[model samples]
Target: MVDAAQKEQLIFVTQKSLRMNRKKHFSESRCLQLFAEILTVDSGLKPAFLFDYCLSNAEQIQEYVQELQQTGLLSENLHILSMQENVLIINLNRIIQHLERALQENGVQVIDVSVHRENPQLAETWVTKQVRAQVDIIWKHLKSQVIQTGESKPGLVTASEIFSSEWNLCTMFGFLLGFPASYWFDFNTSFENCLSMTPLRAFSVSAFCPRITKNLKHRMYSFSVPDILYLDLQSAIKTWQRELQSDFQTQTMFSHLCVSTESVCLSAVML
Candidate 1:
């Protein structure tokens, strides 16, 4: 019963709604308003009619919107609109387009750094490269000591040292690697100290990183390490074995600790 020309028009309208979804900011109310506009124009129907149509197909529309929201591609406003409407008939074209344009203008990098951690070798290479680059730069500018070690894992490296000057190179490197802003713990706060920081313990840092969440949702590679260190190699192996018994194999949290083993050294790269 649908004419080709009318179908094309519907497609165009849908595309427009998607475009808008991309361009706008995080306002739930605004999304509802835009959705209202798209339905009117795309379907040549009144809001009441469109509302009814949506009501009839509520479940499908809700699933679609939820998928978009999980990706961080959906505006929070759209979500609010869905709640108010009691049905999910917002114009997909307008919402998506808006979101796309806004993201472009802001130069927001929505990359999944977690994917880099997928292949143990690749992950190690990336971590080593990042650490080395950071260490090199700090060494050139400051009088600091760096100690680096390679884990048995192919590409993983861990480096730590005290800089002579009060330069926060470790924090900078962590930030550059797209680690959570909270990963930069204070020098005074040891891993043990963080255990008692109840609020910090309550949530995973990856929860705050949108890119990481998106990657995880999409089945891309991610990384996680426990908050506490195993006392020895046997303990570490046992922990890994026990963890693998779970439905989800990956650890959800990671803690980077700088232990004081010895005194100052110049520069080192682990991997």
Candidate 2:
């Protein structure tokens, strides 16, 4: 039906069209894979839709559809429509309205309506004000109780004791790391006081017993101890002994004062 030259031209044209179609199909397949990867990392309708819109505009739909068909990756359940004159128009207004309704129903209030533009300083100020208001309410309740009672309740004493115990441990650790003898002496006094208290006695004993045993084992292994920088080992031991003696004196004074003053107060109250 055609001449030899015409036949050759027809075959060349057909091959070129096929090559172009294949290249376009590969590009679409790659774009779809990228879209899937993005969806895997972040799951949200707005983000997904934004990504899909971008891909659709960047790559032609015919090629994408052909790739989807070839790979059997087309989801029949998903209602994907081609952007044509016959199809419904999708505008930013409709998308925004839908997002607003959905977010509102889900109890998500959009404080900043602007997209991709936010004032960090204003946001920080707003957050700080909210936090301060909450803190003010807590302080108000505390102040009201303080005013009514004229003194904090006895429960605060337990909190103070816990705080002092932790502070003593920190000071002890610092003293072990080349602090002056005076600082170690102060920490030793606090530590001894903590050990004497009923609630804290068990913890102090547990901690100190393990530490002493560990140090003794290390000294036995090495047959020597590290040189003391601020205070000699002998001086440190003497300081600990002095703290113990001072604790005993404090206990004796407290007992005598309580026996004398408490009885006198009771007698006066009875009278």
Candidate 3:
């Protein structure tokens, strides 16, 4: 690591060249110039940008001629490089917490902003003083064992420290906020609570996230990414039978993939 006195930074990365349309992409070069502009404004926070080797544009060797023209938009104080190959870098934490703020700003519906709206005095502390204290506790418990381990590390605390403590703590906040982070934070990325009509209301009991009961993996032949496999129903019976014996719910789910008199399976070979 650099001297402890050195500033920490968020990094912006640029692809040397776009492989899909090398000539056209190299000619336009708008993406690279825009990237340099993002770094220029981050001077107060001291974020950096780095270029990788193997020369294409920088890696694809298109050329950095246009990148050089944008000198005013690049900052020397915010640039950094690392020599150690083993070092790992996280560009930036979500850096954006406070999901409800975005929803409110964008005029999207928010379930609740917290009772803090009713009492301004409780703004930073939110629901309770005790929960704020738990933030440090959770951080210690989390770091005592495993995250980016094997070295003496500094304590890591992301903004979501409030909900990270324990399940009950989050559940408490969930009811208090009228909706937890689950219902709003990037809701579209997860289909877990598909059945629970969130923000509107939720099931009183736990909502089991639905998963692919049948991705038909057996119909998949040994593979790599994007490998094509021919489906043969003959092989799917074992999986179907296994599910049929497990429980009523699973059996009901898998029943369509089976037939009593002529049970079938499927197979595939990567093409």
Task: Give the top-scoring candidate (lDDT).
Answer: 1
Per-residue C-alpha lDDT of model 3 across residues 1-271, encoded as one tens digit per residue: 1122221111112333333354433222334333322332122111112232222332122123223223333222121112222111111211111222323333111122232232111122332333334433433433332333324233221111123323333223222222222111112242222112111111121111111222221110011111011122223323323432342243211122222231222232111
Stretches of candidate 3 off by over 4 Å are 1-24, 29-36, 45-73, 76-183, 186-271
Model 2, span 128-172: residue lDDT tens? 334334323323433343343335332121000011232222222
lDDT of 2: 0.24
TM-score of 3: 0.20
Report the error of model 1 at residue 67, Å: 39
Higher-scoring candidate on lDDT, 1 or 3: 1
Backbone clash numbers for all candidates listed: 38, 0, 17
Over 4 Å off, model 2: 1-32, 35-47, 51-59, 66-70, 79-108, 111-271
lDDT agreement with native, every candidate: 0.28, 0.24, 0.24
What pairs collide in candidate 2? none
- The TM-score measured for candidate 2 stands at 0.20
What stretches of model 1 exceed 4 Å from their correct place? 1-170, 188-192, 197-271
Model 1 lDDT per residue over 1-271, tens place: 2245543443344343343334533243333333333222222111111223223234444444444343333232221122223332332223233223323333111111231222111123444344444434533322121111111232221122223333233333332222222122223433111222111111121111121222221111122222222122234333322432231223222112111122222222111
Give TM per candidate.
0.16, 0.20, 0.20
